[model samples]
Target chain A: MDRKDLKEKLLKIGDLATLPVVAYNVMQLTQNPKASAMDVGKAISQDPALTSKVLKIANSSFYGFPQKISTINNAIVILGFSNIRNIVISAGIIDAYKVEKSSAHFDRTEFWKHSLACGITSKIIASTVGLKNSEEAFIWGILHDIGKIVMDTYIHEEYSQVVQTAKEKGMLIVDAEQTYLGFNHTTVGTLVARKWNMPPALLKVIRYHHNPVLDYNSLRISSIVHLADILCRTLDLGSGGDNEIPIVNEKSWDLMNLDKQTVKTIFAEMEKEYESATAFLH
Target chain B: MNKNKGLHDKSASQDQIDIIEQKYARLKENEPMKILLNAAKEYLTEKGQEKNGS
Candidate 1:
């Protein structure tokens, strides 16, 4: 299929736009500079489930905020509007893409575990690298492989075959998709990101995560997420649909400017946070 | 920065892929993070020793 046809097929797989009403409203509210914290807070409170999850994340060890954050308003204030938006969007994405119980080969739980691991790892990397808005890195990590989920959900039969081909051929899933499906997950994910009106930073990360060539502006975020994805896969944080590892793009690695010591530190931090994070997010 | 190279190189073999797949599977079956942590530690230790030697 051509790129246009593939995107249409992906969009039709499920309601890609079916964010929870609260999440959709929160997203719209966040776009308004004049929107107050209370406005955002009120929108989030409209969904009891989202409120609980947001509060749970606020108190989770992942954030490591010292003071207790019990209320949605408090979470909105303490975590900031953007962070609250990230939390709400994450909850919304999880809801929108609720997978069936794992098939014999693919495990949805494991897939999400990988995503959570990447998010945590990316956040740590961003902070260590002195990037502003490191929390955005967390959201990027979570949404990076959204394309894979799109494929799995919409075209389970073809997706299962793709996974099998990757393993059997010792190929990356992206490569297998190119051979079988004409376009890869990155293309599908980019289209999804555009449709959802995700921020350009996030859209670039989702699009170029597999191949962080730095042609785009969000190179820093994309590179951070790229390295985080590899690290998570290396540690087997959760299955990313296939077992084969992609070659670490030398440029992407260089973009990280990580020393051996930094890698050790990052791994140490991950050790401390991985369990709590997986539990908190999952 | 290098350009987009798409997934695997043409020459990556099934055997190499299987080895990695098995290694990750074992890591998952056992303590996944533990193995990764140990790997990181060993690398640091080796780097330290190499610095001392040089």
Candidate 2:
């Protein structure tokens, strides 16, 4: 579909404009220059389900909190606005997508698991590389392939050729996308993000989330996410769209200043973490 | 930063009607974000038409 048609179409699949009211409210609260624990707490209180999920995620073993956080106010106060905002976005968006099991190829839960793994692995790489916003990296990693979810659903019957082509070439799925469909997921992802009016930084990350070299100027974030996806997929984190291993973004090594040993160590660490991460899928 | 919220949210957002019009201009180039968002946008449009056509 073309851009104009795409925009009109997405409005029907779902009206992102009418996003969960609480999420909208949270966005407003977080946008406040003087946003405080009270402001966030007051906002979160509007959505009990989201509040609980954010609180659970806040005190989650993921953050390695020393003590369990008991209240929304505490979650905001402890995790702060930036961290809380990320969690809120995750909680809201994860539930936001309308994911149904693909008839062929990918299983639904595995796809989401892949996203989660990529997110965690990206954070790991981001932290090691001293990126400014590791959590944001995690979010980007987590949602990098979200366009695939939309694509798979939109052209489930027609796009079978695209999936098969990726398998035959033994290349990253996006390579197949470029060849079979005349565009790659990164390109598609960029368009979708732009259509959604996602942050330009995010759009860049999504556009090059699979290709660091293509985006020479903004290599850091995209490269990190690109590498994290490779590492996660290498470890068989989960099936992200296509099952074949795509070529790892080699520039990621230089971009992040990672060496063979550093790569090994991070991969090993991600390996140990993966076992625990998959456990959360159910 | 123009700080246009339209630049950040989906084009369907009522606040930014022009954004979609501008995006429509670049529809076929197959820019990354467009393809991804197009899948959903197309589905919704088809679904809407089906509902209306029904």
Candidate 3:
């Protein structure tokens, strides 16, 4: 199928935009001015998997909680909606990334690991920059490369060649895709976002994440996603051969609100955390 | 961050093991991934039959 036809397919899928029932309820609670801890707990309790996952996370070393969190209501009051949202989104992402019929051009497990790393990194960067709701930044990082999924399914019918070209030219998969198929994953991803009716901010991040150096109004967000993706790739967490390390953009650096030394410090810290996080893999 | 920590308590060591399984599935293992990729291809081509290499 051609790009246009695939675009139609993605629009029809609509699964990504149609938030899980729990997420939808959580989103509503967030909008509720009178939303109490109980209200948040009630919403999460509806989903058993979410309930367990959240409780499991609350007990991790990150929290150092002395007491066991038993019910959704208590967990919500204790953990707050922000952390709940992160767990929900992370759970949703892991499920969404399970590739039943995957293209060889893409590595499903690696894609997930890299995306998770990027999400974590971007949230850290966004917070350091004093951006409100670093959680949103984390979500954006989770989704920035989602376009790759669509591209693999539609354009790269002959997946082996796509992989070879990316390696041979030392090009990112998106670049190789454009050279061979006349369109890239970013543009396709932007189209995918449009179909999802996502917020404009997110659309901009997806479209321009590959080329943060390009002058754009949403330059800061784009730069964070761009930088996060590269750092994950460089660390070789889940990076494919196609992606490359980008030259740090001076403009992006300015927007980061952290100086070179501060960023380096964070990078060192992130490396340790990333190793710990990936240690879960082992 | 501790907010989420309360939630993690529900997961036992086995739960941790399961999560670790998925996590490790995505590591930088060139040889294993290459093997998986090749097997997937062979499965696709042979249409559920024995392939040349297998």
Candidate 4:
């Protein structure tokens, strides 16, 4: 399909994958400085399933809380509004794209596992790099590969060909996608993220993660997710569609300033936290 | 005969070494991937040692 037609189709698919009403409300409330914890809590409370998930994640060892966080209001105060917002969006997005059928090449379970591992790895990188709010990194990591699923869900036949071509040619999925389809997942994912009204920084990360040096303004954050994606693939935490690893952009790698010791530390923490973070899938 | 057998074993081991080297050549070619693979190797080794110590 042509670029305009492809984007139009992707936008329609984005509409189909809209977040739950409560998730939208929580996002809006968290962004509003005047909105209080109770207001956000009440918004999330409307969806019992999402509230339970938020509470579970807040209490999970991923956060390493000393005491139990029993209620949505408590979770809001303890985990902070941004964290709660991230949890809601994560849960909502995971729910929205329940893969009824996956091709032989794309294991849905492994796909999400890779995504979740990337999220944990991104959070660790953010903290190690002193990026103020690591939770935002977690959400960016989770949503980075969402465009692949958009294609997998809405355009299964073509997506399967892309996956097969990648495997057969031993090419990176992105390259295979470019060769087979006119555009790749990054473009599709950016459109969907735009449709969801995600932050500009996040949109850039989603779009430019494979080639982060393209965007100078969001280069640092994009590079964080970029490195995190590479590390996750190295550990074989999960599959990001293809088995071959892409060459790291030299500029992106230099921006990380990761030493041997720091890499070891990040890997150890990722190993520990990734186990607890899997609670999102359950 | 023993010398010939020794030469054969030496060639087999060299072939095996060559195969292993080829497996990692792509990964080690990239500077960042080389570092990550090395770190991951050490991390796994240390974890294994800890398990044995425990």
Candidate 5:
């Protein structure tokens, strides 16, 4: 179908996959300059399941906290508004996109493992490269391939055809999607992120992750996530729906200016953090 | 006849080697991918050694 029709269909699907009310409220509260920790905590506490998940993640090895973090208010205090916001949104997105079925070619668990790996790797890359806000990088990495799931859920038959075409032709899923569906996941992902009112940087990362050089404004974050996706695939962290790795964008790679030694350090840290970060999936 | 059989076997093994090489050729050619893969290999090897030592 055309872009307009595709977006209309995806917008409908976006409505169905709305973020939980508490998660939505927390996102809004954290963005407000006047909102306090108690306000955000109170919003989160409204959803007991989300509250517990947030607390569990705060105490998990992902954060590497030595002392136990027993309450939502404490988590808010220690992690700060942005970090807490990232955690809440991550939990909310995962809950919203709960997969009900798996096909022969795609396993939902493996897809998520890949996404989580990308998130951890992106955080590490962001820190290594001295970009501010590694937490934001983590969420970007997690949500990068969200369009794939959106399509898979909303338009299963066609998406399966796209996956099948990729497998048969040994093409990247994006390319297959372009050739088959007339538009790729990036297009669909941008639409979904817009529907969620995600920030411009995030929307750009979701859209331009494959070709980060396209957007000059958010190039650094986009490039960091791009490299992270490749590294995760290299280490076999998880499957990104297809086996083939996209060629590294030469401009983006040059921008990173990562030396061999720095690359080694990043890989080592990713290996350690990935083992613990899988807790987010559970 | 034995010499011909040995030649055949060598050619068959060479074909298998070629197939394996082709599989990795894409990764080997990409400079950035090469860097990441090498680091991943070293990291995995180091982890394996650590496991064994412990």
Candidate 6:
């Protein structure tokens, strides 16, 4: 199928088309100007698992707080409605997509490890660059390669071939997907993000992470994820299907003005947090 | 950073055994990412000169 057709088809998949109902409700409430932190907290608290996960993440090393936060209401109050909303969405996404367990060519656990690493690295890079909404960068980095997952889950047989081709040619998986599938995972990922009604910045990260300059409006977040992906691959934090680390789009590298010291510091912090970060997944 | 704190709520039932195992295993096998950063710097310089010459 052509890129547009496949995207349409993938979007039609019942599971991919919508966020879980509670998450969807939270998304709607967030758009309501009158909604309070209490309102949002009550909505999320309906889901026991989500409530605990959100609380756990709020207190994690991901966000360094001075004291313990034992209740959902306290988390919502401190993190704010917008922050809590984003957290709920993140938790919802984890529940929504299940990594394909049987793909002969794919390692689902390693793939998620790579994604989790990128999310951590993206947040750190955003802070290093002094960008607002660093949490959004974390979401973007987590979902950057989501397009690959969509293809793997929905079009497993064809995607297996794409993976094989990528390994054979020593080409990046994104490039290989383009060559074999007439569209890359980035294109499919954008469709998935749109289906979930994600924020514009996130859409750009998923779509333009392979080449961030594609959308100038989302340049900052997109470039941050781009750099994070490179760092993850270089450090072997997690495998993203292929071993070849793509170039750090010189434009994005310069745009961030990254210095070695800053990167080293970020890497060290990432190492420090790595244990806690992946622990959130389980 | 609470070294003793779990990523989730303390009362939550999730185990940290997997996290501990993976952390030690990865640090030993992973490599330095500094080489890529150095290459990015070189590429930026080369691109700047290309623009100037053009």
Ranked by lDDT from best down, the candidates are 4, 5, 1, 6, 2, 3
Query: Model 4 chain A, poorest ten-residue lDDT window?
Result: A1-10
Q: What tens digits encode model 4's per-residue C-alpha lDDT throughout A66-172?
A: 99999998888888888888888888778777644668987677788888999889999999988998889998898899989888888777788789888888788
Error of 5 at A233 (Å): 0.3
Docking quality level of the chain pair in candidate 1:
incorrect
Question: Candidate 2: where are CA atoms >4 Å away?
Answer: A1-21, A24-34, A98-100, A159-161, A168-171, A278-282, B1-54
- A51-108 per-residue lDDT for model 3 (tens digits): 7776776666544568988876666667777766666655654554465645666666
Clashing pairs in 1: none
Per-residue alpha-carbon lDDT of candidate 2 for residues B1-54, written as tens digits (9 for 90 to 100): 122332223332322223333433433433332332343244334434454564
Query: Between candidates 2 and 3, which one is better according to DockQ?
Result: 3
Q: In candidate 5, what are the lDDT values of residues A1-282, reduced to their tens digit?
A: 665776577668767656678877887787688999999989999998988889989999988899999999999888888888888988887877774576767667778888989989998999888898777898899899988988888877778878887978878899998887777889888887788777777899999999998988979989999999988776667777876778788889989999777887887787689888866777
lDDT of 6 by residue, A89-208 (tens): 767866666554647787677777888888888988998899986766777787889887767878877888889888888778998988877788887888877777777778888988
**Lowest-lDDT window of 10 residues in candidate 3 chain A?**
A273-282
Q: Interface RMSD of candidate 3?
A: 16.8
- Which of the numbered candidates is closest to the native, going by highest lDDT? 4
Better of 1 and 5 by lDDT: 5
Rank by TM-score, highest first.
Answer: 4, 5, 1, 6, 2, 3
Give candidate 4's total backbone clashes: 0
Error of 6 at A196 (Å): 1.2
Measured with C-alpha atoms, the lDDT of residue B29 in candidate 6 is 30
Better of 1 and 3 by lDDT: 1
- CAPRI-wise, candidate 4 is acceptable
Measured against the true structure, the TM-scores of the candidates, in listed sequence, are: 0.80, 0.71, 0.68, 0.87, 0.87, 0.78
